[model samples]
Target: MMGVVYTTFMDMVAERFSEDVLDEVLDDPGLSTGGAFTSVGYYGHTDMIKLVVRLSQITKLPVDTLIEAFGEHLFGVLVGKYPTLAEGRSSSMELLEVVDTAIHVEVLKLYPNAELPEFRCERLEPSVLHMEYRSKRPFSRLALGLIQGCAKHYGETLEISHESFDSEEQYETHFTIKRIQ
Candidate 1:
């Protein structure tokens, strides 16, 4: 994975908690990167996973909740870093429809080695969307946060329901998003 993600994850922690808390998470022995991450570098995703787990323990919050919050923070970072991605987009659904085609495509161009989750999105109605998220990493909460963040960014309201397909080997999940009228 790209180091930018790890950097953003750390930034999220620092912003939500404190730099001291971030340092504590990084100082843990579980991180392979030794808590040093750069936006232009590359590292193992496992390192990030360890960091998140540590943060969860420190904050006494669910791992998924922390990850979702990180995802929301990352969305804001993306908006700041790549304003063009949101250009001409008026709603979360509109931007989401093009995430793989437009956003991920651009991310691959910039960081070819980055492993991103696959999203299959269908507009069930004008205001309802059904999306399936599949990833090797267990980071669905991050995706949830990003979806929520998008709605917040677009000044829209939504109700999100999700079910996870958990097994011994992999993770798959479905999200039902209904834009509140």
Candidate 2:
């Protein structure tokens, strides 16, 4: 996983909870990096899972809830760091449609080793998008949060329904997103 993910998660913990809570989460003896992460470095995905588990224990929040919230926070951080990703995109669906082709391509240019999810999208209607998300990691809830964040960024309201499938090889999810008038 990218270190920027860890750094942003840590920042989210601090901002949404408190610096003290962040300190507690980092103090977990199970973390390989000891919660020290740099934006340009890479770390094990297990370390991230451990951090989220620890935070969930400390905050009494469900792991899925925390991951989803982190995803939303991550969207903001990414947008702030790479404004070009959202540049000239007037709608969430517009931005999401190019994620696999444009955004991930740019991400790969910077970090070829970064493992990103694959997305296939179809326009079901002018106000509706059908998307399939596939990844080795189990983060479909996180993807939902990212979609929500995207909608919020565009000042749009969306009705999103998700169906998921999990297999030994990968996790797959289908999302139906409809813009609310």
Best by lDDT: 2
lDDT of 2 by residue, 1-181 (tens): 9989999998899989999999999999888886688988999888888989999999999999999888888888899989987898888989999999899899899889998999999999999999999999888888998998888788899999999988899999999999995
The parts of candidate 2 lying over 4 Å away from their true place are: none
Itemize residue pairs with steric clashes in candidate 1.
none
Per-residue alpha-carbon lDDT of candidate 1 for residues 1-181, written as tens digits (9 for 90 to 100): 6877888888778888999999899998767766788989889878878888899889999998888888877888889888987898888999988887889888889778879888899999999999988888887888999998898888889899999996777678899999995
| Candidate number with greatest TM-score | 2
Give lDDT per model, in order: 0.87, 0.90
- CA RMSD for every model? 1.4, 1.1
- Following a full C-alpha superposition, what root-mean-square deviation does model 1 have from the true structure? 1.4
Tell me the deviation in Å of residue 106 in model 2.
Answer: 1.1
TM-score, cand. 2 vs. native = 0.96
Pairs that clash in candidate 2: none
* Candidate 2 worst ten-residue window by lDDT: 30-39
